[model samples]
Target: MANYHRNNVENVVLGRHHHHSHRSKSASVAGHTFRLWNAASFRRIIFDAVSCGASSRYAARSNISDEKQHLQQKQQHHKTTSMKNNAKSEKLSDLLSIAEAETDVETKKKEEKLEDLKRLVKELQQHEEDSTKNKKSEAAAKVRLLAKEELEVRGTLAMLGAIPPLVAMLDETEQNDVNSLVSSLYALLNLGIGNDANKAAIVKVGSVEKMLKLIESPDGLDSSVSEAIVANFLGLSALDSNKPIIGSSASIYFLVRTLQSLDDESSPQAKQDALRALYNLSIFPGNVAFILETDLVVFLVNSIGDMEVTERTLATLSNIVSTREGRKAISAVPDSIPILVDVLNWTDSPECQEKASYILMVMAHKSYGDKQAMIEAGIASSLLELSLLGSTLAQKRASRILEILRVDKGKQVSGSYGLGAAVSAPICGSLSGKPDGGGGRECFEEDEEMMSEEKKAVKQLVQQSLQNNMRKIVKRANLPHDIVPSDHFKSLTLSSTSKSLPF
Candidate 1:
């Protein structure tokens, strides 16, 4: 039983060992399955991890590209903003330059305007200062009556020195002020200072030209202005050296016209004054020709015909006839002889007759036998007729002509005859006969008429003797003593048988 129990124990122990072995196997299998499952799970997890890693890398790359794009856009925006700022800066610079240029131009204009205003103000101030100084000096000079007059004279002289201002006053639009100024200037000129410098100053002021305009103005002038102008011109005329001023063509023509326009009936004094001025002007040789070139000759000749104008006209004619130019001027007028003869015939005044006869004598001297030519031109008979009613002046002038002819005849008789003698002799011989009345004499009712007629007869005799003597003088002038008589009076008797009168 022990043996069996031991065996059973062995069996039981074997069975237990087998069961332990099976369990050991089952545990091994389970451990292997678990190991395989863990391996697969780990492999799967690794794969998943790798895949996720790749996806995350791709996402990161896309995110990086987006970030780069955003950065580039921001850079472009910054560049555009910077360019706009630069453009604004350039525009502001251009506007600033234009504003500066405009400001400079306005500033220059203002400066120039300021300069002009300063100059004008300076001139005005100077004028006021000079005027005030003059007034003060004048007040200081007024001490006594004689002293005052002396001071007044000095003041006038000073004012005359201030001719620039006085003349400028003429341009003022105010008429009364202009007149007063002009009047003051006239008084200054007439102040008997006789300062050549002052006179020259007045001339420089253009007062002469202005005064002439006042005379010619259609509106006329105040009497004082007229008188002053006349006086000024007369004073200037007396300054013979100033005669060149008359050559100013405008001045000369105006003076001539002014003289012509004066009515002898209305303003005889003015006429006389004008005549005197003309006479003064005539003293200039150039003015003589200029006067003749105008209607002055005709006007003067017409004036001579007027009773009122006779004396002055004669005086003027005498002045004109004294020069070589005067001779030419007298000869220029074709009707001068007849006009002069008529003047002689109408006037019984000694002075008038003397002047007329003197003019004739001058003509005789110039014309020689042309005196006969004048008679043949119908002037000689009238001249002889005029001589029949001569005054003492006429007789003297007539006798003077005869004496000249006689001297000429004495010289000419050295030759038998000359054209001058031949022309003069017959006209002279014709006067040797009696008058139309009996006994070679005529009676007149009026004592004055008789005196005139007697004077005329004496003039005629003198003229005849002059003509005969001129013939002898012409004949003798070209001849030897043998061919022509030394004494012409002894050679030829007064007879109609000698030669026929040309006329």
Candidate 2:
């Protein structure tokens, strides 16, 4: 029984050992599982941290890049703006510099002009103090200088009392003094260019008489002296107050003479100057009589077609034709009406055409003989053409002239046919041209055959009369007999009459 109890105890101990060993193995497994779980959680946490850090760093880098780009854009904009400002500043500086340079040049020119004027004044004063030959030469030089001066400078010299001395120098009387006189005359003329006061002063100082004396000297006048005189007259007579003074003197004679003497050597400018002076003088009605005394109407009429002087010459005639004496003078010229009528054909020169029309209108209105002359000059064709193709004013004048001719004819016809009872032709036939006067017996003849014979005789007579009238018109127009085509003329039945003509 003791052995059995010990075995039992051993078995119990083995069982307890087995139980303890199993419990230790279970503990070891649980501890190992816990450690593995902790390690897995740590690895996951570390991975999440690394991901967050990487994302934050990338965001920082992007922000830095954006700031840098913005900075670059600002710098570029600032650089462009600075360049534009610099360009504008440079341009402004250049413009300012140019303006300053131009201003300096103008200032220098003004100072130089002032100094030149002072020198001229000093020279003029010295010239006034002496009359020696050297002084006379200096006087000539001074006058020559004054001639080239502007109107203001000439006026200034004139106001300094230069004119009377210049006129006094005209009496130098030496044969060599002609040049000085001519110079003085031109200087005087230049002074009177735009200064009326100087013009009056020059005339008041006997410059005109002095110039005339030089011109009318026993020695024949030089062409140069005559030219100077012409320029003086042109300048002096521009003033209305001086017109009669110049015209009443021998100046009109000289002007007309100058115009008449247009030689190869004569400058066209001189001729124009003479015409302009005459035109100025002709403005005064009193001067026209003096102009007529020079017998200029014929010359003016002959010169009407010269294009260079046509306008002024016609203007003079226009002024002249305002008076009865002028109209008679113009009408006395053989070719005046014809020449004036021809001007209407100058389509290119409307001014000349207008002036010529004016002269014709005046002459026609004043004189009946002028009307016949215009008709004789074949003005009818020209008038018809002008009425159709001329300027507005020309058409009006042409129409007016045609009306005058037509109205005058109507008056003459009415006066001749009114109650005077010179003769009346029957409707069928007339006895006016017959040698035997047909009494009331012929009026009663009503046979158709006899009436037809009478009609044929009357038609022959009418055709003869028409030919005679046409010949007269053609002869008066100075046209060729065949001017109208023969067939065209034959086409005109007796139905057409002189009354149907443009004239």
- Which candidate number would show the highest TM-score if scored against the true structure? 2
Residue runs of model 1 more than 4 Å from their true location after superposition: 1-178, 192-201, 213-227, 247-249, 262-267, 322-334, 345-348, 368-370, 373-396, 403-503
- Ten contiguous residues minimizing lDDT sum, candidate 2: 413-422
Q: Residue 383 of candidate 2: its Cα lDDT?
A: 69
Q: Which residues of candidate 2, in runs, are more than 4 Å off?
A: 1-41, 127-175, 187-210, 216-220, 236-250, 261-269, 284-286, 302-312, 333-354, 372-382, 385-395, 408-503
CA lDDT, every prediction?
0.55, 0.73
Clash pairs (backbone) in predicted model 2: none
TM-scores of the candidates are 0.46, 0.63
Highest lDDT: give the candidate number: 2
Per-residue alpha-carbon lDDT of model 2 for 156-189, expressed as tens digits? Answer: 6775667776666666545455676677777777
| Candidate 1 clash figure, as a count | 21
Q: Please, what are the lDDT tens digits per residue for candidate 1 over residues 1-503?
A: 34434654565566556656665433345344111235785576567666666777898999999999999999999999999999999999999999999999999986774554344223322343545534322322221122224534433433424445444433332344334544444544554245555556656667677666665677756555555555566666766666667445455665566577645322555556667777777777777766666777667766677777787787677767766667666766677766776666554466777787787778677666535534434444344444444665576566555444433553421011111222111112223365554422333234345434444443444446445555544654775434533466434333322122221
Error of 2 at 28 (Å): 17
